[model samples]
Target: MQYNANSPAEYIRQVPAERKPAMEKLRERIKKNLPSGFEETMSYGMIGYVVPHSIFPSGYHCDPKLPLPFMSIASQKNFIAVYHMGIYTMPALMDWFVNEYRAHYKAKLDMGKSCMRFKKPGDIPYDLIGDLASKISVQEWIDFYQNSIKR
Candidate 1:
C-alpha cells in the first residue's frame, strides 16, 4: 500500500471504511500488548512500532535514515497483515511462535518470514502476536539486528 501518512492516526483514518473496524481492533490489541520502548508511527505505508532513533541512533541497518522497525499492521487490498520483525531476527522465537500457534489455535500458520496475513482480525491470534511483540527490548533488538547483519 502507498504509505503517505505522517502519523499512525492519519494512517488509520485513511484505511477503507469497510476495513476500519478490523484494523482498529488489531491496532488496539497491538498497542495494549506492545512493549515499553517501541514507538508507534507510520512506516512502510502502515502503522508501525519501532525502536526510535533516540534509543537506537544508528537506525535500521538496511536504511539508517529510518528507525528500527519491530512490528507493524496494515490493511491491504485482499488481506490484513501483521509484520513481526522478531520472527525474522530470531529463529527460536519463530519456532516457538509457530509451534504455539499450531498447538493451540489449530489452524495452519499462514505466514511469510515475518508477515502474517489474514482476511480478518479474528483469524489471527492476537495474544500470540503480543507475546512475539513482547519478546525483546529495544536494546536487545538493536543488538540482534546489528549482529545479524554482521553475518
Candidate 2:
C-alpha cells in the first residue's frame, strides 16, 4: 500500500509478483475504456486515474498539487482494490452498478463507497468496471465536485 513509484511504469514494477498479472489486466481495462481527459499517474501510493491539472486547474480540493482523482488501482496488503469516484458521488450510478454487478457476477460485492476489493482476477467484474469508468466525462466530474462543495 506504500506507493513509492514516481511513474505508472514504476508503480507496475513495484506490485508484488503474485498480484502483478491481475493488476495489469485491471489497469489495461480501465485505460482502454477510460473517458477522454483523464490521465494515469501515481497518487496516494497507488496507480491513479485523474483529471489532470490542465483540465481542472483547481485540482483536487483536498490537495491542489494532486489531480482530481477519478479512479485508482492498487495491490493492497490483503487484496487488489479498484476505486471509482463516479459511483461514489452519484447515488443513481451506484445503484445501477450494484444491480448490474449482482445480475452478471452473482456474487456479493466486496466494496465500500468507492473501493472494490478483489481477492483475485476472477472476483472482478471487468466489463462492468470498464463501463463504470466510461460513465462520466471529465467536465461532469468537475461540475459534480464543484456542486458538492457549494452544498
Candidate 3:
C-alpha cells in the first residue's frame, strides 16, 4: 500500500462490489459519532476522519496545513484496522477502555502501540468501539491540546 495523497481515494474507488456494504456500514458508524469540524475523507490510502488543520493549527507534528486525524478505518489485504488517536495521553481513558474491553470480550486486545486491527467488521466489538468513540465532545480533543503541549 504505497499511500500518498491519492491513495485513500484510489482505494475507495477501487473497492470491489463485495466489500461495499461493510465499508459503507463502518463509514456510517464513524460518521454518526464524529465530532463537529471533523472532516471525513480518504487520506493516505484509508478512510480517514480528520480534524481540520485550521481547527488545531499545530496539528500532530506542528504541521498546521495537515490536519490531525482522529482515526482511519481501512479494509486491508490482511485485516481491518481502527486507528485510535493518542490514547496514551489520556491514561484514565485508556485504562477504562482496555478494562472494559477485557471485561466484556474476555480476551486480550491486540494493538500495535496505538492501533487496533481485526480481520473483519463483524469482528469489531461494537460496544467497545462505540464506547470509546462516544467519549468527550470535540472540545475535549482541543482541551487536551491546550492543556498538554507537544513535547
Candidate 4:
C-alpha cells in the first residue's frame, strides 16, 4: 500500500490495476470540484490536495516545510481511503457529510476521525466526495485551522 511515488501520476500508476479506475475517478472528482487555490500533489505517500506555501507561507504547523494538507486519497491494504482535514476539524462539516452519506448510500458508512474507507472501490460515492471537496475554500480552511486546530 506504500508506493514510493514522486508525483500524483506516479502514485496512481503504482495503484493495483484492479483499483486503478476507481482511483483515477476519485482523483478526477476531487480535482474538478475542489475550490480554487488548492494544489494537487503527492503528500504522505498518497495523492494529496493542499494549500501551497505561496498561499499560506507559515506552512503546516506540524512541519513548517510542508504545505497545508487539505485532502488525500489512498489505495490502502483493504480499502480506498479519503482523508479530509476539514471534516475532522469542523464539526458542522462532519455532521453534514454523515447525514448526506446516509442519504446517498444504503451501505453502512465506514469512517474514522478524518479517513473515510471504502472496502469496495465500486461502492465509492464520487459525487458525494466531490461535494465534500467543494465545501471548503482555502481561506476558510486557513482561518479554521488557525482558530481551531493549530497548537
Overall lDDT per candidate, in order of appearance: 0.84, 0.89, 0.67, 0.95
Candidate 2 lDDT? 0.89
| Ranked candidates, highest lDDT first | 4, 2, 1, 3
The most accurate candidate by TM-score is 4
1-151 per-residue lDDT for model 3 (tens digits): 4334454555655655565566666666777876677777765578887777667777666565567767777776666677767465677877887888778874457767557776655666665676676675566777776677644
Better-scoring candidate (TM-score), 2 or 3: 2
Q: How many residue pairs clash in each candidate?
A: 1, 0, 1, 0
Pick out the ten consecutive residues of candidate 1 with the lowest summed lDDT: 119-128
Best prediction by lDDT: 4
- TM-scores, all models, native as reference: 0.91, 0.95, 0.77, 0.97
A best-first ranking of the candidates according to their TM-score comes to: 4, 2, 1, 3
How big is the positional error of residue 31 in model 4, measured in Å on the Cα after superposition?
0.2
Q: 17-121, model 1: which lDDT tens digit per residue? A: 877887887888788878788899988888999999999898987899999999999988788899998887688998998888987896567799999888765
Q: Which pairs clash inside model 3? A: 8-45
Q: Which is superior by TM-score, 2 or 4?
A: 4
Q: Of the candidates numbered 3 and 4, which has the greater lDDT value?
A: 4
